[model samples]
Target: MATVKTVTTADAAAKLDELLWVVLWQPLGLPRDIRHTLSLEGEEFELLAQENGQVVGGLVAVWTGGTEIELRHLAVASHAQGHGIGRSLVTEFYRIAKTKNCERIHTIARNTSGEFFRMLGFQTAPGQAPEHPIFREHGISFELMERFVEQGTPADCSTAARSRGG
Candidate 1:
């Protein structure tokens, strides 16, 4: 079974860094400051996942309003891809965000993960918000996606469900 939890404190941030590295970042030539900034305090919310006491995936969310949430990242271990770990993690984030009255969610995603986000009800656009720093990075490219929620269905929720029998 998989479980998710919110991250708090600098120590947990450090742990999340390790998880991001071991599962995604380091293997992809990303930097560690990504983890440091994720925990820089005043973040609206974050969710971390674990299986058998080890981190496997995570999704970080920040609130923009009563009905708007920004998905900073939704990462899964390479080995855990296609296992529903990412979906479950995001589902859990939605449950929490809903409690906080967030009915819309947006994400700026890498080229490869846009389809995954779309499957989860996140849509893609050619341009990004001005303050999103998308153009700051030179080599990397991204697309912006948004999902509007109505009665628990994500605005961009595609037909893709976890491949599990559930």
Candidate 2:
């Protein structure tokens, strides 16, 4: 059985860095400039999946202000990819996001993951505009997908609501 745990302290950060960043992202050209950005943030969390004490997969998210959590990284062992590990990671992140009172979560998924995120009920932004944080970054231009905790509060709606009394 696999157990999932939240990364909360420096020790957890070490484990996470070993499994997720060094082992995975570095091989895929995620850019070294983003390494400092990946360091533990005051509002971020790492969800780790371990079986019999050996880490298998991870998902990292950071609260991006005003009740939104942004997925920084997510991956399952290449050998573990087909066994629902990815889905479980996202679901767990959603559970954590709700617990943290975040009204929504977002991620800038690579083209390869378009279908994966779609299966999890994430929708791509309908415009070419760089409205999402992930897009405003200096080195990437991936599709941004967002999942909302409340049905009617679309990304644009949240901005609109702030100008009203609702």
Candidate 3:
């Protein structure tokens, strides 16, 4: 089973970056320069999923001002996609957001992942998604989605996620 944990050290960050590159950027044919420069501006942190001491998935999020967190990137290694690693990481993301008193979580999801976010209770937000020429050329699109954090303790979020079969 894959276990999720918060990423705190530079080494962990680098590992997560490599995982993201392999699972996301590389597949998209994005260059190293574009991938490395995609970091978001606010306070950022990450959660990583590991199995048998190997990194398999990860999430990057930014505290986007008052009561909102923007999930920047979420990816699972191709070899690990069938497992619940992605769900585990997002559940932990919610737990941490709740602990920080955040009231909502938002993400700019790729068209391919909109359904996945929907399953987690995120709704399409009322705004036009920003377009990138490169992504468009690659037949990829983006959507803005968000979900309000239910009023509860951090543990409550985890319990709720499990009950929902996430």
Candidate 4:
């Protein structure tokens, strides 16, 4: 089993920049400086997943005030896909969000990855705009999705739930 750990921007900047540059920016034709989007000025955080001491996946999330969080970036290494790394990172995010007293977490998932988020209990966010201009400019289409996190409720992290090994 892989392990997930929380990291600060200063601790994982280089690694995250590399991952997001390849997995997100380059593919989206967006500016390469991901720092502006992954800031840690307020209640924001990053989670990294590793297997046998190697980084495999990561995600960044920000608190949108008043019990809501927005997951900004989530990507797994190309070679590490199909393992449970992505799922583990998201599960850890849910665990952390609960600790922050968050009631809901939302994200704008790429069209290609929408089903992945859906399988993890997210549904189309109500009243979301039909299009996001910024991403549209870059030829990317995203869907807004959100998952509610009620107190004492076990988050359905994935369709086929499995124990997160220690």
Q: Pick the candidate with the highest TM-score.
A: 3
Query: Candidate 1 residues 1-166, lDDT tens each?
Result: 7787888778666666676667645654556665565442334676777898877887777776657788877788777788888888877776666666677777778767777776776666546543324333533457777765556544223232332111
Q: How well does candidate 4 match the true structure, expressed as C-alpha RMSD?
A: 4.3
lDDT of 4 at 56: 82
Q: Is candidate 1 or candidate 2 better by TM-score?
A: 1
Backbone clashes, each candidate: 4, 0, 0, 0
- Among these predicted structures, which one has the highest lDDT? 3
Model 3: per-residue Cα lDDT over 1-166, one tens digit each = 9989999899988899899888888877889666558777799889989999999999999998889999999999999996878878888888788888889899999998998877766779878998988888888999999978887544444466445674
TM-scores of the candidates are: 0.74, 0.72, 0.90, 0.82
Shift of residue 72 alpha carbon in model 3, Å: 0.4
Which residue pairs come into collision in candidate 4?
none
C-alpha lDDT (0 to 100) for residue 28 of candidate 4? 65
Residues 62-158, candidate 2: write the lDDT tens digits.
8888798888788777666767677777777776676667887888776667677777767776546244355335343468888776543333332
Candidate with the larger lDDT of 1 and 3? 3
Ranking by lDDT: 3, 4, 2, 1
Backbone clash tally (model 3): 0
Q: Considering TM-score, where higher is better, how would the candidates rank from best to worst? A: 3, 4, 1, 2
Give the clashing residue pairs of candidate 2, or none. none
Consecutive 10-residue window with the lowest summed lDDT within model 1: 157-166
* lDDT of the structure predicted as candidate 2: 0.69
lDDT of 4 by residue, 69-153 (tens): 9998898988899887888888888878887788999998888788778767777997664575666887668788998876676
